[model samples]
Target: MVTIEYIVDLVNKHNVWRGKECINLVASENVMSPLAKRLYVSDFMHRYNEHFEKSHYQGTKYCMEIEGFVKRIFGERFNTDKVEPRPLSGGQANLIVLAALTSPGDTIISVGLTSGAHVSHTKFGVVGVLRLEEKVAVNNEDLTIDVDATARLIREKNPKVIILGRSLVLFPEPIKELREEIGWDIPILYDVAHVFGLIYAGKFQEPFEDGADIITTSTHKTFPGPQGGMIIAKKDFPDKLWEKIYYTTFPGLVYNHHIHRLPALVVTALEMNAYGEEYATQIIKNAKKLAEELYDRGLKVLCADRGFTETHQILVDVRDYGGGAKVAEILEDNNIIVTKVALPWDTPKDATENPSGIRIGVQEMTRYGMKEEHMVTLAEFFDRILNRRENVRREVTVFRKNFQKVHYCFNNI
Candidate 1:
């Protein structure tokens, strides 16, 4: 058997190397603050809490306190009525929301995976519970969600729950119109995993105002917290609904919940409360600038004709470069990191084998202090490699050294 200690040591080495080199452009990744990282690796690593403290856990007074703080931070940041901070991951949080709102075999309507919807919302992930029976996509021209298409699908299929959100949102979701079409009886689940920070900062769509029944998100994405999840409901919430989360989470599903991540998340939320708006704005600006620069450098960014993006992420079609995976590989060779993604209209097989798009985002690099000028320079680096210019490695190394000298890493500060 592989020894756990060796694995742990290897992971530590990998973290160190990952920290020092490479520009992380993957949409779902973020660098935690040193304070947050410390909390995750400390006593919190050894201890586990299983109950809500009012129930079965043995030593959970302090755990509940931290968890309470975490929930309060989320409540204040998002202006939601209540927040539950105990889900193990965003996917888990989404699963809990699905379980709470719908029963087995209930139909769920969501964006298809090619349209940037996460697996958790589909039959592939939560089908054992959610039973996703309908999915919609966006208009090919602007890559925006097709509200009319969604309305027609809902009218035809009549799903029990309608989920409006995405893994690669470039603009505000069409929540206001969708709710109006579906009426108030159906549960509208907003999976705001990618845009939670942007939403807090007043840059994304307002889910509550538009009538979403429940909101689920990952704390790490734009919220800039440690890796964990949250589920929020509007005020005047029912106790039975909350009970679903509590029961499913405790004995039904997850155990050994990380109590320490909550405190760190609380700290991160406080930081978000202070700088969330400006950070979100800067992140969007950088995203647009990067996408535009890349397009100008002969890359094909989705929605380039409609303004690269309003959010931090932009999808570039890399089909000309042997598809997204090949483009991602070439970029990785030059110290940049991005992920392969399927276009909203691509098939599942295309997504798995030869997806046509690359997902890039500005959140992490923005947190690292890069701006539009850096985006232009980064785009030039891509040009060097893609256009097959001479001395590509040496040129990129010099450019990266200059960028690093700006002291972008949080620890360097």
Candidate 2:
């Protein structure tokens, strides 16, 4: 007896429960601004626009204008004139870039899942889909890519492309060092999906100046835009490479490009231009504060020697408390959301069933105006739930109620 009303009720329930009651700590998610959310649902959603240039469909002049404006804003913000805001997700962006940069059977180097690489970077996902060979880069003691080892591997293997960036990124990658080792002839693509907001706000390293030939990211995550993907390249990158990317994105991949999200993405880009620095600074501070407080509370927070994190994420080894999956479930039951994650030492099997780690991101909470003190309180919640075996769901709901309003955007609109 399924009906439209039942579906609507389910949607409403989620909107209230997840939106209003829980403290979201998912690293790969974010809340759009009120204005951005409103603009996200528009006439464009019902229409279609094909190709990057003039659309093949009629009544798309305004869509064309918004797309161009979005591209221009990203270009100005990132200090590059070549920007593509069309891919549907970060995974798709990676796919487009890979299709453009390498052929089937070509070898590419990227971080492995155990070392915090996203699945899209591995043989299990798009790399496999494209029939490319994925070679994992070595990791140091602190879970960062081992620059010297990676350089040696590049020399020995002669990979078609080197991909940098991580899902559990804590410190900035050695993009400059790796580039120096490999020389300027090789292409290095940095997938900044996880740290997009931090980079946009200048709180994280600038990949382009650090020798990344191309940068790809999803517009959501820390960027706080509606769900979509974007790619930007250095102005001096080979024109042929750019052409390959363009063609792969259009005829080779997407057909419509989801025009409705353009306006909201533009609004988010503008908001970042206005309030990005302050917001990014707060997010990093909150992540550090939360990590420190969790460590002080006797939790095994990762990279304490490196000040917890330079970006919005924090990782903790939760295996001591019945493993990551169990701990994540317990935390979610208490209205604290986090994802079970594989640490550097985890095997492929452990990464799926019972990982040894939990990943937390403070960007969304920071966007909701949570400060260092709030981070301290949040860490206390984790302590109560994990260490003391307390049910703090009611308390967490009350605490989250005060943070429902989104910050760092033009709220008055």
Cand. 2 TM to true fold: 0.99
Tens-place lDDT digits, model 2, residues 327-396:
9999999988999999988887988899999999998988988999999899999999999999999999
Clashes of each: 2, 0
- Across 1-413, the per-residue lDDT of candidate 1 in tens digits comes to 88999999999877644554677788887877766666677666667687654737566677778877876766776576478777879899888777766777677787767677788887788744465455554443455567787777787777777877879788777788877776777777889999988887778878788788788899888778788888887764567777776677767667777777876787677667667778888899999999988898898888866788988898888888888888888887777788988886578798899899899987987887788899998888877777664235445555555444221223432
Off by over 4 Å in 2: none
Lowest summed-lDDT stretch of 10 residues in model 2?
48-57
Q: Give the candidate number with the greatest lDDT.
A: 2
Please identify model 1 stretches exceeding 4 Å from their true place: 1-9, 53-55, 128-132, 137-141, 389-413
